[model samples]
Target: MEKSTNLSTCENVMTCPIRPIGSGNEHCPYDWLAVYDGRDEHSPLIGKFCGLGKFPFSIIGTSQYMYVEFVTSPAGPLLNTGFHFNVGNWPGHVETAGIKHGVCDWLLSSDSLKDSSASEGIFLSIAHWYPPNTSCSYHIKGHVGEIVRLYFPSFRINRIESPILKYEGDCGESLTIYDSDHADPARIIKTFCDTFSRPMEKVDFVSTSPSLYVQFDSKTGSYSGSSLYYWAHYDFFNNTRFGDPVPNTLCDEVMYAWKHPGGRLRSPLNSLIFKRTGGSDVRCQYKFVTDRRLYARAIIEVNSVSFKELPYNSNACTRCHEERVDKLVIWEERDKYQNNLACFCDNIPRAVRVISSADQMNLEMIVQGQHAITSYFKNPNPLFEATYEFAHGPLCGPITLGPSPDGELVFPYKKALAMVSGPMAPPEHHYRREKCIWELKVAAQRDLWLNLEKARFADRSCDSAKIEVYLAGRLEPRFVVCPENISLARDLPILTTAELGATGADQEPLPVLIQYTGDGQPGRNIFRLVWTELFHLPRNPDGSLAASLLQDGGCDFRCPGDTEVCIPKHLLCNGIPNCPNVTHTSTLSQLTRHIEWNLEQLGLLHHAGDYQQLVLHDESPEICLKRDLSELPYGKLSLIALGLCLMFALLFAILRRMCRSSSLHQGRHHLQEDY
Candidate 1:
């Protein structure tokens, strides 16, 4: 019976299935069946049935009638066994005959390494097939200085009882690799076999040369069993010498783009850039890992600096009306849009420093093409660069008390409150997230003053890294401060923070909580505060209550002319009576003049309109209220005035009776003592 066929002249290569040799009880010998391309006995062999050949083989040419012949001993009825073949589309090149995809050898180049909708890195994979006679070969080559690093995450080929112990000999149904541009057996690097003890083992290899050749051959011999196992998984990295990229992270990588030179591992500071001459989309991900308790900061120094396109006409106010050419996006997590930290593009170069809120950050850079192929080739322009590092900690100053020997505190004042830095520095390798909390206290009956002299934050705004001031026993904080207001400390004064005990109540010292966060940007994080323990000043001192209050310095604004009175700035012309007599101004001009001097003194000239309004009545609502009491009927106004007078008279009578009763009680107490 015919054993194998030759279809060398077939126009397209075909995939053929192998059939069992014979019926039950009949066993086939080793090398029982074989198939070749041409009828010429010297033509190269393609596959075989129980021999050193692979199941998936190429069939070539038409008009080349395939010949199948059995090879058996001259003694026993031609072995009474044979094989059959059927044809279909080839497995390796199905989508396109010549185009290679799905885990195949590829030529390394700048254009091929880039990720696109149609392809990825230079990767290859071989699936497990049951038939014993299955063999394949792959070839890879690249330019000079480019080395191939082959990594096999998974490898398993045929369930053989034992692997070939000899290093020089080939194993049964094994895969052979060579570090050469050709299929020269002398250049064999290693041979992998599937043994019972070590069924699967990851394999990694780096080619010393620029080319690599690999071939997988199956030779079942006489061991024809129903069950079989065969598979291999691998990928390649070029332009690098390191082998086996598995179980290793690239946290120390400084450059993520394809073309630019990367930074050294231990470098303290480094910059990353994105540039492309081929006008293709580029995508890369990087993870920042650190050991210290700190945060990270990334500053965009230059973005697309080489691109020189300007507005088309002079009428255009800005020259930034072009298409987006590049983007640098940062994420708190690996997934997109979940915790997107920020997105930097060409326009609106906010020059903002990005702070990582978490211990690790994921960054992705995508360089989009803005022009056509011809445009890019003639004038290729795309550039992006940024620098990143760990930020600094806050500055902790001293806390001094009022006239009480600088930093020392006596009894009742067990705890003294002052401004303290965020926390200690992070380790050398990497920085982590950190938080600090402080408790403040002051003397009894005295008020606590906290002044934030200087403040700097990880971000442009202090939202990510902020200080929360809360009163003791309060579920919510009384004040939440951010760095945006304090980013540039110009002439603006640090608003004074004061806490006083309730009137006539003997209570413990006040307690305030300040929580500081060092979220990544420690180099930029800074805060300085000064706290002073003030003495309790007399509110009504010798009929000079206002003057005493002014001396205490608690008031933000002090009324002129009547040097004896002081009032808060907000209470100025808000339909309230805080200042003494002759305060009513009939015209806007008169009102402005009356408060102009005091307003200027308090640096509140900007708020002149707040108190500049013409009114017919002695007292009117704030200038913004716009309600005129004179518009009301005269009788109605008279009635309202009369009601107010009657209410006051009733209140006075009640107060007089209470005073008389108190005096009578005191007299009785004194008489009892005398008796």
Candidate 2:
């Protein structure tokens, strides 16, 4: 037989029964078949074979024509089974019509394939056996704003078995894909090898950019049973629905919480089939931020989740021992510890809501162990879908109540409590432990009074409720009250800032914190309290009132003639005169009467006689002056008196000297007559 082709192969020879041949080159002396590079007998002989065993394997010729001849000895045994052989042209390189650059590089473009209307096509490797030490690359291009997707219909390649002696090279065959036109290591999307004993499943690939590069490489030739080949289809289309990509990242994206307050979030290319790259797990973080002030927290509701299932002895959501299973981790990005609020894996049955404690939150999708050929095909679409929204939290107050000296503070703030009261409210168990705080403040140097007007509970026992009052900058509560101690609390005096030691320049705006901890059941647990700003009275170390120049019992210091105006202690002795008629005694009797009245109201009438005597006898200026001087310590009054006497004597001496100078300046005659 003669054939014209670049390459030819002769294989599948059947066993032949013939006279036994000797050995070596002369083994097939009788009934032998010969293969030649040319059609005629004079052509170069490639190989000659014939024997009792099926020994002549496959023969390949790389010439334009291949010739084979078969002959048998006339005296061969009658029981001999004639030899059989098959010859044909080997499979050639892939069609070169689409090649654009290099010998085996092909370029496919959506614009060029516009006539097909679908903008899609398929290509294949050699039909049968592939050439040894060969490489082929395919470049897929799309227009701006368009993305390319590639799918494999059929794939089979020879897997190189480990040899006893190691060598330097890659696998016997491999298929690599890049996200971009260039085959940079960092841009590689995935790589596939025929390492599994069974057949590989179908797979899909997507390009983040407009172009995708695919390369198939073979390090060794294929034998009879193994055909190193594949069939792939590609399409180009617009993908406008993909979220805005994050800068300096491969597949991450940012969802602005402000612009899209409530919307859906999905894994990258949610609608397409994709496999995680080999070697490492694929992680994509969707960050939610901005407009944190508009909401107290973020809520994410997972609609569906699909991932590769992993075997475990315990619950996978709490603890995942398997490294190969995929996971959807939800957390608050603002949390320094990165505590995961919820972790979901495998298949989730019902929708679950994850509420973040902070304003900003993150959802991370992790795809693991998809690099293996079997896994690549089996787990093509491992992804999750969720909806998110910014929402107000259920907790109440860090609220500040101030400027107005007195106001009522109610626990379980009406508005916040209403939010958790309806049919859609959270389960009752969520209110097992709840806390609410309110801060009360007053002007500088003023004391605050707190009185509990009402304390009621649904259970009536109040075992789950307690109220605490704390001074500013103090951790310990000044007073704690509960239903069990209600009688004692009622008997106790009203709580005051002065009594709690929260009075001074440093403690201005005297802040008092009222905190309530309870089950937080709406309307079931409630309380109301009132606060009042009071004047701070100064006391002496002996438990009596401090010595005041004007001993008006009610007022710390009262103006002499103004019964209606009460002067604060700070105003006394200050350079600016705030009181009228400071030297008058007309209002002394009225002031004393007022003092006596205030003392009676304060339940201190036992000291009324002493206060009456102090105001009545000290009304005269001379007596007032003596009493003021007597009040000074460390001999201050004596020093003042001595300094005043010296000042008067010095002034008199200066005046006398000036008069004598004036007389000397007069006419000399008049001065002599005077002398």
Candidate 3:
């Protein structure tokens, strides 16, 4: 039968309604019905069929013209029935045609059509018939920020059986879809075989990027008692409805918690328009970040979580221990790898709330099941939806505890009581990883004392709570104590600065830092510390009050000879004499006397000798005079002084006699010149 030009606008299929009596083999059949691609016997033979089989078998032709012939041998079976067939055409069917070099490859784009209404359409694997031993690829491209959505309304492929085993082998004919325009194995979104098409259910696929690739591969050229065909529709639309796209990423997104502070986060698989056909694993991360200075923590309330074929139960999180299971994992971005807050594999009915330890939180959905079916209908896709908000809670910043002499400090600071006591109180675990710091200043001339009144922890090992005391100008803590350290707690009333060997002589205010870190179980970890200031007076090592040595009130060193000048402790025994009463001639002796007395009074005389040696040498005039006066007897010292004076007088008389003789000689020389 030949179709006219007007009637040949679509593909033609011929159906036969008779079972010929012959072997089913096509090459050597006794009785058979022959079909051709053209109007005459000279055309290519499509297939020859003969056997007792179902009637009304159909064969689709490659074009409008087709030829058919019926033949029977004289020795054919007598039970053979006569054959008759009909030829018809589908009006609007589209066939898979090669676009380049006879290769079944096509590039389809949404931008090809200017009309918005015509941006989406349908195509089929076989408008007439798919060529055998051929592979066809369709690349669908869309605009930026747009993703491709494809749906298969009808799909069927012939199942190839093993020749030796006589059972189904690997799928010889398959349809595969890639998330990107390339047929890379890693980008493959889903693959369908005869087994997957047997259910006759509609399937959906979506691309994470702006392009998608669909490939149909038929490995064998012959038919296997079934028609291999599929019908699919594709559309391109913006993906902003789900979330803002993260740059340089396909499926990942960044939810704006810093600007909006409150919003919803949904898994990409949750969308009705897009569902993952699980052949490979998929991981998409949703991130929420806030300004940590304004918000202390981000709170996430999980509305629901669904995993393919995984039932909801109390142990859902625990049951997803295997790395291959579908799960939703949550954690703070700062500690993403180290600390995962929770993992869910099933729906959460109670709306579990999780608070991040810091300002940023991340939620990742992982779909790793090789055979899991992710659809919006019968088998729900792996999905999770959560609502998040940046929270500003009390006691999140540094605090100045006191100018008061004695006061007590309690952790959970008293103000946080309101957050924990009311009917709207959050669970105790919400406060996990709480950190607080308090500063206490020790007044001048006073010592700071810290007494740990109470230290309690839920875990007796005290790993949950940590208490540290840091002294001024120190990086390392002076005291690191936990509730479990009974011996350390009993040794409290610690002298904050003195324990570090700091003398309180300098009248500067000392700052003591107390930091408390809590493990968020309410009422389980508690810390109470009382600080007291004690009047401190510098004292001598000899059990005597060193204040007796001060001429001026609280002076460390005093000038001699009633000058009333006082020097600081650092100036005492220094090389330079700073005392006002001592003169340049007597400075050394006076400074030495005063410093020696002061050092002795302060019980630091042993330390004074080292400084005195640096300032004075034994051969110096002052030292020699002092030594002579001190070592000689009183009578010998006077005789030595008198004898030295008489020697000076004899030398002066001899110098006077020499000067008189020189004057008399000059007078005689002048008299001779006059004569």
Best-performing candidate as measured by lDDT: 3
lDDT of 1 at 225: 20
User: How much is 238 displaced in model 1, in angstroms?
Assistant: 16
lDDT of 2 by residue, 416-462 (tens): 65567878776877654555555576655555556666777666455
Q: For model 1, how does the per-residue alpha-carbon lDDT over 1-675 read when each residue is reduced to its tens digit?
A: 234322122244354334343311133443355444457545544334442223333333222444444564444232233345564432332121122433333333323443332222333333322234545566655456454545465444555532111122345556666888766888887776644324434445656666777665655422222112333332233334211222342212333222221231211111111123244554545545432222222222222223233354232223222335345566676344457766654444434444444335555554444342323222323334444443222221122224220122121111211112224433434433434444465444444434455565657765566666666545466666676655323222212223433334345444555555555333456566444443332355454333443453444433333222334444444443333332332234533344554545455466567665432121234322332332247898799999999999999999999999999999999999999
Model 3: residues with Cα > 4 Å off, grouped in runs = 1-34, 39-43, 48-56, 68-85, 90-104, 113-116, 156-168, 195-203, 222-229, 239-675
Ranking by TM-score: 2, 3, 1
TM-score of every model versus the real structure: 0.29, 0.33, 0.33
For all candidates in order, the CA lDDT equals: 0.42, 0.58, 0.59
Candidate 1 versus truth, CA RMSD in Å, comes to: 21.2
Residue 668 lDDT in candidate 3: 100
Residue 511 in candidate 2 has what lDDT? 58
Q: Model 3, range 236-269, lDDT digits (tens) per residue?
A: 7665534566776546876665456577767653
Q: Model 2, clash count?
A: 0
